[model samples]
Target: MSSVDKQLDELKTDVEQQIPNDITVTDVKYEGPELVLYTPDPKRFAGDGELVRKLASKFRKRITIRPDPTALTDTTTAEEKILSVIPEEARVTDLDFHHDTGEVVIEAGKPGMVIGRHGATLREITKEVGWTPEVVRTPPIESSTVSNVRNFLKQERDDRRDILERVGRQIHREQLGREEWVRISTLGCCREVGRASFVLSTADTRILIDCGDKPGAEGEVPYLQVPEALGSGANSIDAVVLTHAHLDHSALIPLLFKYGYDGPIYCTEPTRDLMGLLTLDYLDVAAKEGRAPPYESEMVREAIKHTIPIEYGDVTDIAPDIKLTFHNAGHILGSAVSHFHIGDGMYNVAFSGDIHYKDTRLFNGAVNDFPRVETLVMESTYGGRNDYQTDQADSEANLVEIINETYEKGGKIVIPAFAVGRSQEIMLVLEEAMRSGKIPSMPVHLDGMIWEATAIHTTYPEYLRDDLRDRIFHEDKNPFLADEFNHIDAGEEERQDVADGDQCIILSTSGMVTGGPIMSWLRHIGPDPDSRLVFVGYQAQGTLGRRIQTGWDEIPVPNPNDAGRTSTLSLNMDVSTVDGFSGHADREGLMNFVGTMNPRPEKVLCVHGDERSVQDLSSALYHEYNMRTFAPKNLETFRFK
Candidate 1:
């Protein structure tokens, strides 16, 4: 047998010896990066978790105790037991039994109440049914994306297990002559702020991070040239790690699956849910525009099946020589700052993915410290001189003022927000401000993909800031679902009625006014002098939002008279850009991130920002701290020792 095989056999034997003699270990297997052991009676050691915890500490690997197939009760009895054990007040919504994974997924409206104090209810169910209990939230607003991905995981159980087993064998393979130089290639989103992709490679392993497309027409936009960077086929890729689900950071991932890549995708559970919604929406938008989509929806489904949802700070083996851990990036719902531990201990690299260094209503600020970091790949979206927008308190005050002024004048405030981050933040801001009497409550409208995205956020409240989660679970107050916020129908006939009705505040998607229901709102309100159009997020270059931000009086939009034609509309409504509320750190925040690192990064690479922002941040870090820094263009490669 090979050295890896010998090691695996010895490890299993050692674990078998260490566990209780009475407990029957049905099987001890390496599932992906973690070691899982199946037991005929997991309840024998399930009283206080001491046995499992001790075994995990001894093995020095993630260990999970799963029930053997024979020990598990059938679906009928398992569901009945689960329903009986969980209290009625918990609002159990759905139950899914994943036989392949030996897990019984219990989805509830109030997941916390279902678990009971000290997780007594879950422990009882696990002991009684012999199947591990996994509790997931059923968001007040249901997302089709969440449903599809959950169903995919359930139906393709055999396929997922096979993929994980193969990946596990690959990850644990014997290291082939380590101790070498490391290289990082910026495949996309280097000098400009879209299509963020990168490749990290060593002698034996090649991994891609953030394979996304620039938000524009496929041929017209500059995107990551994956083939050029790899020089090899997609089958050679060891893994693909997503930083977040933003279209600019995840849109092109389906292309990899469509082209022949069937490797595992590493990301947080929330990121997977969001990616499904965003990627499928990308195709739908293209189809509506009478343009061919970059990839069919099936490719997206294929991508979902191969994904491995990981939590923050879980050190996992992706490549033979690479150990990867994700830290909170605080940009969107499940965005992450990837920290790669390369070789035995030769190098450590941290890639900051669109970080917001200051806490917003939805998430906390980005995490700067890591176990080890030698090179830092950072985003500089607001790194220019004088990019410090405003304090959160002052920004909240400013937003209230803008809305009150417009509302008092009998003019509706139409804010175009990005669906993922900004839409949720704006909703909370409006909800809280109204509750505190800072801004009078109006009929707040939510439309397009924003509501579905919000639903996904609710399902993964644990990924949110601690304070927000407390308010949702403990305090029984979820700001996103406040009665004042109205989800407008994503239909033409219903939306036009809102535009013609009495004035109120509307929050719609495509923050930059690039697309989605925002277009309809603008079309109806742009020519009205009394209505106000607010831009609360970044307006990308070349987008209609940026044009209006630059004082464009007339803008071309789809002609309502004919779908095939377009018309120019005069801008008569008030236009305002709130500088605060950006999901990226300013120059000061970026400096603080580097300055606070325990062992300061010796080398820093700037990315995912405009020309000025990236350059300014790189130069500042180099000159101010006397550190080695480089801001490379797309397709540029940087080497680290």
Candidate 2:
């Protein structure tokens, strides 16, 4: 048996020994990255946080007290009792009871009220009831993604509980303890713009920081080489953690599961929800293009079963020696800068995942504080020469100028946007401009995944900026659901009506026009002399979007009338790229991000950009900060301490 197995055998005994005989532990389980004690009386553990806390410390891992299935109150009774327990002011929108975890998820409008003052209300609920209360904020605007997740949770409760239990045991499995050093492998997004992924590992523990796909690449994604580097199978990986939900950072994760990875996937709650929306949409696109994804939707479901939605700043155990705490990345809702504490402070590495150094309409600036950071991995998407960007206000004004110019000319405006971050951001800008009467409300339409992603943005309002959050929670203002914008009706007649109609704005996805609802819109509007196409985000090289942005007059598009046929599209629409709406930090933003780092890191690694951008950013940081800075490409390993 391995040392981890032997150690777990001993650790399980220790956990049993630590608990008094008065407390009955029906079963002690090692769930992948945690040790869960199933007892008939969970209140016994809840009432004494000190006991569980101390035991977790002794084992140097997370310890969860799950009530025995036999001890859990019936769902009907539990629901009624919980509703009575929480004040009506809480506005409980939804409640979920997970028998396996012994957690009652209370999704309420006023989560603070559900929690009560100083958590007295929750404490009372727990003391009186046998379940632990996990309160979530119900968004002012409902999210289909979150609603789907809730429904899926309820439907697959038993299977999900089993998945968690098995995963917990795997994470808690005893691995050899080595306090020597760790290494990082740049799996993708190095000297490249898409497929943001990487891997970090010690002698025994292994985890994937990100497992994204090459959205812009024609044939295959930039898959990680760690499995091959280790000479073991891909299943050797212990955990898959994402910094955000962008397809470039999260698309290939489910495929990993299809390839035999069955461990936990850790990310912020919003990232989890967004991933569910994006990953499935990716497959839908694949089908539209007459190709199939490497994995099926079933794999996505399996991946979701393994996902552990952790809160930002919650120090979570994902490996035997790794404790991960996510800091706000401020790129989009629920985007996070992952701070991995490896081996009891033996080493630490921080990854800035598509950071926005300045505040945007969606979120605050990325965090600069950290207890200790030895190595920092940051995205340098806009770090090339002459990559300076315009301010957000100026960019917004320029967009309005273009929109009004198009509107005045009796033309339509087609914006190709990434459905996740860029879509929501542009929608906000349009809503604000139209609401302020800076531009006329000329029937702004949202199509494909853009509307779905927007719905998700509403559900996680807590991840948004303070000002936006306050308005949504207190004053009941949700800018995302502005009346000026119309969800592109799914009916063929309605879409054709909008296409044939007069001057208006349409927001559609597959930001790069690789494939999405944007193509048909482009096919019809592209040849229009007065119509316009605007690029708000980075148009990855080789994508159709980049071709138009670079003045490609003719393009080939799949015929929507007959999927098997293709049609050549002639470009006459005026195309322009607005600079400031990008989720990534520009050259100045990147420089300032490192400048503001508290107790600067000793080494810096840049990725998520082209060859020039990565090289330029590394050189600039190296010369300016006088720190070791480098950008490693695919399959290259950087061993560090």
Candidate 3:
């Protein structure tokens, strides 16, 4: 028998012997990193939760108890039982049943009510319906992306199960060789801040981290020419771990699936949904610009089919010899700092993907604590010596001052922001400012994918900081659902009306002014001396946003009337850049992260910045901590063991 089969047999025998006789064990199977036990009487253990906990502790694995397929109630009966069990005040939005796993998903506006006190309601529902209940929060604003993703998974339950089983077998496969040495290949985001990709390899396993794309660059995708990434075809890479949903960190993932990569992509549940939304929007923006996207939507669907959503802090085996864990990165809704425990604790490495060490209104600061870390790879996006930002309080005050100043001038405010992180941050700031009368109450237009992205954020409130989560969950106060924010969904005509009609605040995407609805707004407002153009996020070098900040008088924009024509617009708007709104850690924050890390690392590698910023941070680390430090460039390899 194969080693994996033998392992499964041993696990099954142990579980059968340990579980109570009342709970008949029908079968044991691997579902990705989890070992699921099928029983006819799952309710028996539901009341005694400690039984499953003890079993998990004894086996040193994640254990899931599910009702056997034969034991599940019919869909109609199960739905009826679920509704009767849940309170009417819960306002349940939708119920979906997955037959392969015997899981019924219940989406409701008030998830806490559905869960009940200490999960009593869930336990009762499981006992009565013979189906495990998974509660989801229905966002106040409807998100088509969330609906489509959930529906697609429901439709492809059987296919997803097959993919999970395949991945589980690979993860549990026998180890054949010694992990004598560990090496990392820097494929992208080393001396520059886009297309962040890295390959971590040992003698027995290979893993890819953050396969992204660089916008407005000649070479858009990561440096796949390295032998560690695509040398033996896409399938050679065992798994892909995403840090967040930013385009620079996730855009090119679908391309991997296009080239026959069927391996599981590990990420937070929010990251999975947000990345899907952004990638689809990427295709739309490319089509509007008359450019052919690297991959088609079919590849994106394939990617979704193969993704395995993991919660933060759950250590799961992605390969036979490597275990991965994720920590909150405090950059965006689902950003994470990935920790790799390779070769049964032979070595430990942590990759900080776009960390913001200071707490923002949207999220708590990045986590600095880890069990063990010998080598640390971190981003240095704002790591220059003079890259310190204003405090959050001061930044907010300045933003309010700017808004009021522009309002008094009888001019509109145009802010180019990233749809995922910066746009949401600005929304909170504006919502509070307007509510408190710090700034005049006016329409805050959400253009491009900002509305859809904001809707996704609302769906995952637990990922937000404690204060924000409590307000949304307990107080029922969602700042994103405020009255002043208007979702501009009526296409170009509505966007044009917002730009030309009134004095309001506009938050549009392609944060750097590279493309998207921001371009249209800029084209209309650029020559208006009364209007104010405010930048609240990092404008990458060579982007039009940066060019405008550097005093570019005239800019060329695509003519709306003609397909292959351009028009030059003179820049006369008042330009201002507010500091401290960036998601990346500035120099001081980056330094503090290393200094405050638990059991400080022995070596440090600085990445994800411009040439000077990476080098400056590496030098500072070497001098300040007296540690071995390096600023690696693309395609460079470093051995840790």
Candidate 4:
């Protein structure tokens, strides 16, 4: 070993000694001039920034500390590190700390590969590591370009803020009314149902309903922190009402906390469980990208403590004379349709938080009846009639056909799906089909946070569909725990097992293929022509999954290295998709829900749809319900009642 290697080993031994027995050294290695050490427990050296400084002092060289490579372990290989800095997830390849210059370097691929869209990665990571990471392009690596790149990124950040300002101004102008109002802004997610952020303001309280990611055809639309919505001067908001735990609706909650919104986060029991799964994963991804997550791990724990869990149908007062109630949205296990009895009937508004029109295998459809409210805030995810009639049976058959075809050809089938909603449904469908011998029984691998989230789902059987709850309670036949399924947690050996598996079915997360174990699995399987990569969820633009889904013959994936960061693995898997498995109701479903409303909402605000989707849905709902409808642009406020 060279002097660097010797130092790394010595440092590893020192850290190993310093770390309590509970924390293990999963790996240690030299990356460029810096000695990087990864420990199983991130807090093993907490408040030990001094220890790190001392360690680097010994090297007379720069050094960095990070969570152990194994700390990011999930169902896939140890290579992919879901970043722990930003709200979104990305596959991080390599991390470098330059001793000579005190610069940290990060290399990622695709859109997420960059620290974050619009400098979010750099800003977030810098806050976390107490140092800024300079991101480098994949391959043809050169340090000389750092200054030029930094200038360019800074320019991009400024441009992004300008755009948000323009959008915010337009939204505010369009939405302002003589009376206080509420506006729902849609963020479209390509692979899954889009999310919406609701801005509700009275004379006193200003609340952002659900601030989450809206999937777009590409990577998410740039996340511009809406400064106006954050409020200026004394007109700050009171609290945020989280519609549910879905990422699109709840992922950005930390940013609020990060920016000093000292308010309560309100949601339901299952939503809380799901939020735990999402927020933890979100932080994990941010950390890996060399950016600090907006909220620290401790903040997440603290935020959870402030989560005021409300029961469905119970009217709880958030402020003087302002009561909030949650009705089962039936879209996901713990999702709700929110009713805000705001200010003495001046504004009786309801937000349909991604409601489902029809019952699913696991949950009831959205509650059809509610007190007749003046303003109805709804999701237009399937706004247009284009997706009115997706044949679920056909989609299920397609899943089987794709799986059988891949298996018959002696290849593995990898399904990239959402951990909470999509994964559970897919598992049930696959399990039932296998039980009926409709498809061959294979080694089914669950390689994402799905199993853990599913375990949490079990804690709230009352919220699930009656049959599923009955199966869990009486028959003890938990659909999520079929005997054929194997849970893959992060570890060297299990990842090797997955990579080496000859024929199998594997499911993983960051459903849009933004990050998670799926990337590593894709790296290993994508090169094989026989391998089938099926996407059961939506694919946003700029994501590797979308690139592949759009028929890109090859794509870059993360290959983790012990040296510091990671490198790209070229992916060339046979890709397929099944849109029917989507959790959101389709176009007809949206219209049906609107058509069924009792005293009929006078005004309909359609959000959570793309431009095309929103426009189409708005027109259709008008024709069907004869309700005045508007698809408000982002941040646009609207007058109600």
lDDT of 4 by residue, 1-641 (tens): 54434644666787677655775666565432234565545444433445555666664434545554333333222112325553343435566553322345666433333556555555445434434356643321122222333333344544433432332222112222345544433333322344456667665556668767654332343233554366462126556788888777787776666667655667886686577668778778656545455567655544554456777887665643246889888777789998888766666778888878788777888875767577788787767658664577888898988988988998999888888888888888999999999889988888868777666656566788888876765424767667888888665468677768778888888788876777777777878888888988767545677778888775555545532255665565677878787778888888878888775788888777667887888888888778898877764556553
Ranking by TM-score: 3, 1, 2, 4
**What shift in Å separates residue 41 of candidate 1 from its native position after superposition?**
2.9
Tens digits of per-residue lDDT for model 1, 1-641: 97666877888788879877777776677778888888888677566556777887897678777887887899999899889988998889888887766788898988887787777787888878888888888876777878888888888888888888888888888878555989888787887878888888888788888877765435533334455344578777789999999988898899888778888999999999899999998888777656788889999988899899889988888888999999899999999999999998989999898888877888988988787899999888888877888888888888889888888888889888888988888888888898999888678888888888888888888889898887777434878778887778648787888888876888887777666677777788888888788888887777788989999979877765575466888989998878778887888999888888777899899887889998999999998889999889987777787
Q: Comparing candidate 2 with candidate 4, which one achieves the higher TM-score?
A: 2
Residue 162, model 4: lDDT of: 42
Q: Say which candidate scores most in lDDT.
A: 3
Write candidate 2's Cα lDDT for 1-641 as tens digits: 86556766676677779987778876666665567777887767766657877897887667777777676778898888888889998899888777657888898988989888766777667666788788877766667788888778678878877877667666655667555779988778888987877778897777888877776575557565446322377777878889998888888889887777767899988898888898999888888888767789998888777788888877887776788999999897799999999886789999998899999988899997999999999899999867988999999999999999999999999998988888888888888898889999878888887777877777777888888877677634778767777887665667789878878899988788888788888777788989989999988887888888888988888988787568888888888899999998999999999988996999999998889999999999999999999988887888997
Clashes of 2: 13
- lDDT string for model 3 (411-518, tens) is 999999999999999999999998888998999999888999988888888888888887776534878889999999898889777767878999988899888888
Clashing pairs in 3: none
Q: Kindly give the number of clashing pairs for every candidate.
A: 2, 13, 0, 42
Which model, 2 or 3, shows the larger TM-score? 3
Q: Write down the RMSD of all candidates, one decimal each.
A: 2.1, 2.8, 1.5, 19.8
Between prediction 1 and prediction 2, which has the larger lDDT? Answer: 1
Give the higher-TM-score candidate: 1 or 4. 1
Per-candidate TM-scores read 0.95, 0.92, 0.97, 0.68
